[model samples]
Target: MPERALRNNSTPAELAVWHRISRFRPAFTRQLVEAPFIIDLACRQAKLAVEFDGSQHLDSVERDARRTAYLQSKGWTVIRLWNSDVLANPDGATLHVLEKAAECLGGTHPQPLPSREGRER
Candidate 1:
């Protein structure tokens, strides 16, 4: 199995929530670092990962710490968000996740070519 498949073991709420946030047209894929065991979401191009932590995560300090360390070792910047936080403020969390991904991408992600919308300034 791939690395991502081993990572994302999020709750139903988190999974459903991230599914929406992932709608953003990022520079690359949204999920692929490691799967079921993964934190939450990720942008492969940026080498950044996002985790939506609910009650379970807090209950296991050692597991969380080890996971973070593993990601860092793989050169991935990890962003964590509490379940309640995301439920209360999804927009903020999504933006934060994007920013972290951008940070990993060196902050200069190449924008896709403009559509044929006509522009002759």
Candidate 2:
């Protein structure tokens, strides 16, 4: 599906988590296209990909595993959270994403992209 459509049709669990973490400094993109695949959510600066897996994923364990391995080989850290877990504890799900971002970025706060106003103009 197109990224925009994916965002518009996002599951309740995804919307919940997005609202919680979308304001992070380095920012995140939902349904981010990464060539052959479209990651559920990705923070490029942190090289982190977050996926909210629903029941359909249960039947695709091997496929998912290979995808994760491929992403890892490409230097991306993939984190998957169960849809029910996200719906049950959105805060925790957001925290896990933040924690993984921090870890991947090697810091608690990623250095923000400077705006024109913050640079010599």
Q: Number of the top candidate by TM-score?
A: 2
Q: What TM-score does each of the candidates earn?
A: 0.70, 0.86
- lDDT of the candidates, in the order given: 0.65, 0.88
Model 2 lDDT tens row, 1-121: 8878898899998999999998885789899887678889899999999988999999999999988888888889999999999999999999889888988888765545556785665
Clashes of each: 15, 0
Highest lDDT, which number? 2
Q: What lDDT is reached at residue 89 by model 1?
A: 71
Q: Which stretches of candidate 2 lie over 4 Å from their true place?
A: 110-121
Query: What would you estimate as the lDDT of candidate 1?
Result: 0.65
